[model samples]
Target: MVISMAAASAPTTEYVNMYTLNLFSLAGGTTTSSTANRMVIEFGRGNGVVLNGSFTYGADGALSGGTLTGFEEYYAGVKGFDVLGASVPVLDFANLINANDFEGVLNAIFGGIDSISGSPMSDYLNGMAGPDTLSGLDGDDYLDGSAGDDVILGGNGADSVRGLEDNDTIEGGAGDDDVNGNMGIDLVHGGAGNDTVRGGQGNDVIYGDAGDDGHVNGNLGDDQVFGGVGADTLYGGQGADVLRGDEDNDWLSGDLGNDVLYGGAGADRFLFRAGSGVDVVGDFNYAAGDRVQLAPGTAYSLTTVGADAVINLGVGDQIILTGTGAAGAEWVVFA
Candidate 1:
């Protein structure tokens, strides 16, 4: 049964009547008491009412669930609810929740915005006001959650997407396409294409999948990056990071902080500068044409320890390139 309530922003002074209900009571249970299981607060305002509550299930207890309401905090169908202050995503069907971005799979189960957890609600999703989550299933489609915290998934095909505000997650499917996290903490996956991806603000995680010449930038955030195939360029901006150039020729640099870099295959370039924290490069193959580029006017010394090459650039700061034999001796090139 759907017990209703007013959205928190609704003024309670004008509410006619409010109901405190137990989940089992909706099925006509005995009475209202503390041990009555789940307790629901129904805020009835204007022409409708809506519900929001928290509950724990006892073997003989009740379970509480949130309800749908208009932006004005009324159970007035789907006029669409735009939350005030912070945010709560109006993602799929019926399940209009607040202050929480439920993370699971995008099962589009709603006729429009607002969803119950784990239901595939939409084939294509458009972002609404407030923190919204949108997902795409099994096709090349477009997704743009206009504002707030959003989650976008391009399950397959060449797709275009944008997360305009708050923390977001965007996954681009098999086809080459564009995906951008405009604000907040974001996680992006470029699946199998020469894709261009950028993390606009806050902390972000980016992955470049198999394809020729992919470009990725960790604009803000202590990001983690993986270049999964072909020639790729990865930049770690203003944060401690881990960069793995996996497969084929790649170019990588640890722009700031202590970082770990891996030149996985073919010829690769690992760059560093003075004042940047000590960074390490895993799997630096000298025979594969991998080279370490140092900033101009930087003074440094090189040595080998048990197949590992270390560069000491004064002030006890150093860069260790591991996983190579003495052939790595010739791998260092100052830029």
Candidate 2:
């Protein structure tokens, strides 16, 4: 049962309802008193929900009511059954709406601008429409920010995080993760793992931070990608971009832009293809297996312009390898 409740405006009077619900009666039980095995609150607001809060039951399965206090205390007032003729504002139960009954996966579906965290088990956390925050505490989780500009954290697992529409900030905390910035200009950081980060369709900023053999791709727009540590692979997909492979033996590909590629400290390979616009390889070390790979059947001519070697691909696209001059031809491969 998906129960969606929209928050109404504050009441004229200041009466917060600290009411206790009869779980047995609500579930249509035969006995006078019983307990609800689990309560699934759907489309709920997450204004002031803490990470590990819980509800308790008596030994006889009766509701041992707990204190539920939050932002809804001021906004979500319910009318009709009032005590002392004053309207009662519903207690903001942890603004988390559970989508499933399974023990393994905790699906938190938040409606309003809220913040929520997952359990130690694997979870599927979704920030449905608000500018919210979702944190996957510890498991191989899946997190999606469906519409609003959200903040998502893959806390300590090999997770998959997606910012579906608006400008979001995503961090893959500990394990190897796959992070995707789907639509708007986002900021993504793959932290402490050999992760794959993609800037999909916008002028995004992505970082493959502290990982070995990580992959960072700027799929479209004028994006910026940084490969923080280890042997990483970076790609500048379409618009004019900047790709930096900070350390180790990395591969940098400026696929179709008038791009700037900086092979920071490693023996890096700069890849070029047909329609790859005029690009610049900031530090191409020809002696350290740092070469340029071109697409097959690409008509190209090499020329020396002072200290740089320019591979002009006949159709107005060229790659300028800095400092190598004619010697760069030995490091250029057609494959």
Candidate 3:
């Protein structure tokens, strides 16, 4: 025997000998033992249940031995399930069950949950269990790739992003920005404006799209930097700045002005036209074996050196000459 109690208004009785009974469209009501021999009670919309006696299921497949009271006045829709004698509604177990089942009945009750249309202003933050795709529909927003190889975008505004703990890809769009890949191998791009980027703890790739940009302390790992257009500063903080005197190299200029350059490691080349007062300074170990190729009719002087082949140039002078004998080579004025 199976019995279910539901809240309904008025005491109504129906007799059925079957083990299973499906009750529908009930208000709030109570059932006495004499009311039925076996029972199945189903709570309809806006229904509540209050059981007064111990319930037992009979071998004949009927719900038996329970008294249900306080059918109508005890249950209310907006207030949830009210207590048997209290006017104020308290936290009820009924609401928990209803809320838990709300998701299961969503398709039948209201067709289906609809997608949000028009502009979206919220940023999506996703967790490790997701191989997730998030869109920053149309706002200055922030998206996080918490874990799992993720992709993030700064839709607009000067946005910032940190790839917390995975190999992630991030793009900053249409604004001055900062991007950091906190762990794992990552790829980052500064979409526009003066942007600052760092590959926190991995062999990372960063690009400065436009405007003056700065890179600091991007440790270990072979990294690549391109200062795209405008006067940009590139610091191969611990590695080499692959100096290609292309259209984007800010240090490769040919006008007569005091300039400073450091080739921290590896062979750093300084290419200049005549009249560019380029100064190269560093310890003998870092300055040695680096070449400064000079153009015709350029005036330069190598004023100080820690060793015979090591030299530092004072302000308003240039280092000229390249080849095997170039280091510690004396500067001569060409008329």
Candidate 4:
């Protein structure tokens, strides 16, 4: 049975009500009266009601007196009454709850409630207003942020979380989880295990922590990414992964392994390690000031149409030809 109550009192009055509440077997035996087995009371306003008596239970799985586990004390200046013993307060009353009241209830219950404790197949659902925090304690839970700039914590067991349409922070606590930043500038962290993260459509920051992490793209503006402590794959979709520069000069670095680098437009530069290769194909154009550096054990060939020099090298044979004249300066080496 669900019981809901509301109090109407003057600025300086104390109101109390009691009912013969049934203590069901699901709520545990009334003999387990210690604080560990007691019902948890959460108050909406700072100046609300208090639970004044203890609960009594009968042998037929029925309750004699209602359970009076705890009391909620609201600050004297606050305008609302304290909700007595309801697990979830119904603040849907008009003018009783504003944006601040909704937010205060969430902040008061951040780590205070345990949705699931001992079951592996259990799930908990919570709803809150803007700038709220939602934590999925255990059992592969799923969390959804309806609205506002919210924070979500996926505790354990390979959870899946999504931010609906606002700027949100989603964290994969400790499992092989999939996190997606649906919209807005979101921050997502794949806490541990091989996690897949996607930054939907804003300049978002994504971190792949410990395992092979893959990134989709940074759609607009400059996006920053790091594949932390693992073989990470980063893709700077549209905007340049600008390390340092001005006027659309973005930088991308493929650290460790054979990483492919591309310079799309503008005066972009490619930085490679000692054992890297840079390949150019198809009508490649070079200005007078452009330079190319070949690493050790690396080879480069160029074919020109007019007043240019071309070199072709073969096994055990060499050639050094140089001239601007039409005679075609040539040198040949024998096997």
Candidate 5:
């Protein structure tokens, strides 16, 4: 029973290089291959799966070990697929996994391949029907491209990454991480610290790089989030999500559908709970301090009528705050 948030700091940035997934296990667990290149696991689609050797494809296969056949083993999703994508602790599947039927964790990863896909010898690969490619280096790592269209990377520390189904691309490049793109059209990046990114259905693009705090979620579709700098918490958890709270003091949410919230400079807080359908706060910034949060017992009453700032959360849960004159009334607050 613990819930705490409100101490904000960050907003936006766009840069790409994200490559560092430090995963361990020389045989202890979490899948193998710590480095030295060569780790391919493909089958089912794309170029095609079934890299037969019966078992043992090490030595020149890179990592220099042995035995990799069919492949089939499961354990309840395994913390969302690790190594910089977040969720670490016992993620292994070398019981010689080869099953691709039930359809869940067996074919979900980089359909495009990684290390640029040039395939020096395949710098960490995972497929069974994938636009495949996987990468990881350093310490705390784990990568799971359990299906198609995959690209997973993580490094530094505290990593656990996954593109568990169709259309995937993940990057948890630094530390304090957890990434998941369980369906299609996925793209995730949480390159620094204090991170927890999730886009569990589709149409996702998330970035919370360089950081003090970031906990992002776009769990359905039509998602695009960027809160890079610190103190961030953006969740457009159903669909039609588009949030950008780029700087300090941020806590935005379009938690159901039909959302478009953006409070980009600083001092932001926009939350409208209870389904939250017709939401639109393009840049609800009144001065340098923007605010609008209502969901605690939720019996509100704030009227302006004329210019439109009606926030009556009781009956049908209406909240209309258009701008023009005294819009949103300087800034409404109810904790």
Candidate 6:
């Protein structure tokens, strides 16, 4: 003797789940718990916990497959979490996603594009893979573009940012920032405030754009660097490079490879050391207190060819002072 029952209908309650609706709503809470302020959503994998309102088929609470529309507004909080098993702590999602310690993963059937943003408070954002756009809206932020070509912005306040790999674009929007293009042909800008920027590898373009002072270095590859409007220090660390101090007093050094240097305005110092390569000093203003500083214990002689002054460092190394004459000799200094 067996009992037969009719097939049940679908649950029409439209209950909330960890992946579909705010978890706080399902728990009968209006506000997030103090400990649960951020939600971590890992894309590329569509998986999450679901809480049904009707308990149909006794499936009130279970893990279910879900999708992320990328329009979900629950990715903010305080404190950090590690993604992709990397020890790096990602930015907290406060006023953005409510999950004190709640973690969610948004599965994308086909690897999707991600746009990650931060709050007015400090944030730490890591775009682990794919071409992602990360913006630290306001506050001191830490941004890491771990893989793929990425766009990272340190919106406001002092920020620490890095383009870890591939071609990337990074900007230290405001406040003092530490910007590093760790490995890529990158474009970097230290927008305002004093900044320290480094083009770690590959041919790069860097700008210390308007600040009290800036330190910009092209660490490798053929690079182009500009000191937009400040008493800035520029370095062409390796490869054939171009460095310019656009305004105010500046110190320009072509550290290696045949390089070009420009002292755009105000009093400028052209620095050279042993193995600095054959470099050029464009716009050397003698009466403007411009000076040529040489390495310590270095012996050098100067000669005037036509209207230009040439400093012979050795058999194959020289600094050609374009359009400078004998008057340039008086400003050469030993350092």
Candidate with top lDDT is 2
User: How far in Å is the alpha carbon of 227 misplaced in model 1?
Assistant: 0.8
lDDT of 5 by residue, 63-139 (tens): 33432222211112211122212111111233212332222223222222322211111122244454556555444
Q: How accurate is candidate 2 locally (lDDT)?
A: 0.68
Expressed as tens digits, the lDDT of each residue in 51-159 for candidate 4 is: 3335444666333444333333333433222333233232221112233343444333321322212113323333333454656555565666546676777777677
Worst 10 residues of 5 by lDDT: 1-10
Q: Write the per-residue lDDT of candidate 3 for residues 245-301, one digit (tens) a residue.
A: 113334332223333343333433444444445433332122433345555655445
Tell me which of candidates 2 and 5 scores higher on lDDT. Answer: 2
Better of 1 and 2 by lDDT: 2
Better of 3 and 5 by TM-score: 3
Overall lDDT per candidate, in order of appearance: 0.58, 0.68, 0.41, 0.41, 0.57, 0.67
Question: Which of the two, 1 or 5, has more lDDT?
Answer: 1
Off by over 4 Å in 2: 1-109
Q: How far out, in Å, is residue 125 in model 3? A: 2.9
TM-score of 5: 0.35
For candidate 3, the per-residue lDDT at 90 reads 15
Q: Which pairs clash in the backbone of model 4?
A: 46-74, 46-75, 47-74, 48-82, 241-251, 242-250, 242-251
3 or 5, which is superior by lDDT? 5
Cα lDDT, model 5, residue 136:
53
lDDT: worst 10-residue window of model 1 = 16-25
Give the Å shift of residue 327 in candidate 3: 7.2
Q: State TM-scores per candidate.
A: 0.56, 0.70, 0.41, 0.41, 0.35, 0.72
C-alpha RMSD of candidate 3? 19.0
Q: Candidate 2 on 105-163: residue-level lDDT in tens?
A: 11222345656565455666666776867777777778887788989898898989999
Model 4 lDDT, full chain set: 0.41
Q: Which stretches of candidate 1 lie over 4 Å from their true place?
A: 1-126, 131-143, 154-160, 295-298, 304-307, 315-317, 323-329
For model 2, which pairs clash?
Answer: 45-95, 46-95
